[model samples]
Target: MENMHIVFWLLKDISWCMIWKPLGVAMIFPTLIISIVIAWRTRQFMSELCHNVAISVWISANSYWMISEFFHFDEHHIWGGITYKHLALIPFITGLLILMYFYLWWQPRNKEETEIIEA
Candidate 1:
């Protein structure tokens, strides 16, 4: 029946079409409220620094994923030395590397127990 075909098309096409709403909810909402709250509550420079840097990394990755997947602007390198298309990725990759360094190197320093461990 025509109605059955329409139902199937709607189910398959419409349901699978949109993911931006959920992504925005997950990415934007927490960064706005929770990350800032956690950073401010700590009142320590390292903790706040780590949280803010992590947020930047997250934003860059989210933008990269959204633009590449949804807009399809990431199909191929535009050409020339580091084309315009590749420029968008610089911050994303750099942010990730910085975040990694913070987590692996800097995070451990926060736990140094000068009273117990030093003795």
Candidate 2:
């Protein structure tokens, strides 16, 4: 399943690079769905859950960025200085924050739990 997800992700990126709008757009669904499923399946383990969820969010950000470029609005400013492409930063930062929380706070406080899970 993970391998298939990678295949879909690569296809999505390749399509984006080639400017194949329809295929790129279509690829988002499977890429995102697989990420979500992976996250859900790993939800019992905090570390895996955090990493998987972060991956899911990263894919979302990537997909949105691709779509923005496909639509030719990636450079159009939506705020004072922020462009539509910059909106992708929302999910990108969110994924980073999730990982930060896991590494900086949750994991530190739950060392025993992680160790037990690893066993």
lDDT of 1 by residue, 17-51 (tens): 57553454344433434444544555456645565
For each candidate in the order shown, give its overall lDDT on alpha carbons: 0.52, 0.97
Cα displacement (Å) at residue 31, model 1 = 4.5
Model 2, C-alpha of 71: deviation from truth (Å): 0.5
Clashing pairs in 2: none
- lDDT for 80 (candidate 1): 58
Name the TM-score of candidate 2: 0.96
TM-score of each: 0.43, 0.96
Superposed Cα RMSD, model 2: 0.9
- Regions of model 1 farther than 4 Å from truth: 1-45, 80-89, 103-119
RMSD to true structure for each model, in Å? 11.6, 0.9
